[model samples]
Target: MSTAPLPDLVKTVIVPARPDRAFAVFVEEVGAWWPLAGFSVGGASSSVAFERDPDGRATHLVETLADRGTAVWGAVTRWDPPHALAFTWHPGERADAATRVEVTFTPDGDATAVVLTHSGWEARADGEGARTRYDTGWELVLKPFAEHAGSSR
Candidate 1:
């Protein structure tokens, strides 16, 4: 008998803007809408940012809290504009144990369909719980994303 593959956790939303615009809001202005307090490494109030290295060698998605300083949530794996973005997500864990999160933007007339998939949980010990946690967490991220990205139009 063959074991089935692990299921990916997914969240999809439709933003009231073009794909490029939705992409910009997600990448360029993540700090504006990302809920930094309850959803970050610090577990307190903080700011989230997608900071690209000036030397073009690295990009970090980090959480910055007043007392906790900065925490690395992930590193950028793909940066395809207005289409797809993928990253390694290892918040509060070793880099070697990181999972992958991929978000894609599809254009639908003036609106944009945003689909986010977080996979590779088989690497973690608490993969099942993590997946459940992210199911709600990702929804939190998407609500603000849709609102913020929509208003930018």
Candidate 2:
């Protein structure tokens, strides 16, 4: 049997929005904060949609120079409003493998602390590459989200 390493990444951010509002924006306004340039299923991701229901799907749609791509990242495994959102995460070639992602929003006085954990990756040939991509991706995406929340405050 082939053996490969599993992928994992984590990121955190503090946003000015309250916990409830921050959580809402994360699920509802994903298109505004997701950095979909190099990490998209295709070229440019047109939208990132999250369905809140248990087992609901999270999809990313993209359009390239000559082709379009759509990918189902995973289903919602846990959904606790204003506190936690957990789901499976897999991208492109790693689709068959499963991973878990948890985003927690904690009340920090008036602001919110957003902590993200990406783990449970099944070791595969490209697992390390996926980990690397997510490392940079989370930073990129969270930066904008934090800024957006801060500006609106």
Point to the candidate with the largest lDDT: 1
Per-residue lDDT tens digits of candidate 2, residues 75-112? Answer: 67777887998877765645457667899999999899
lDDT of all predictions: 0.85, 0.70
Model 2: residues with Cα > 4 Å off, grouped in runs: 1-8, 52-69
- In candidate 2, position 40 carries an lDDT of 60
lDDT computed for candidate 1: 0.85
TM-score of predicted structure 2 = 0.78
Per-residue lDDT tens digits for candidate 1, residues 54-112, read 86433878888778688888999998887999999998888877889999999988899
Model 2 has an lDDT value of 0.70
lDDT of 2 at 103: 93
Alpha carbon lDDT of residue 54, candidate 2?
A: 50
Model 1, residue 89: what's the lDDT? 98
TM-score of each: 0.90, 0.78
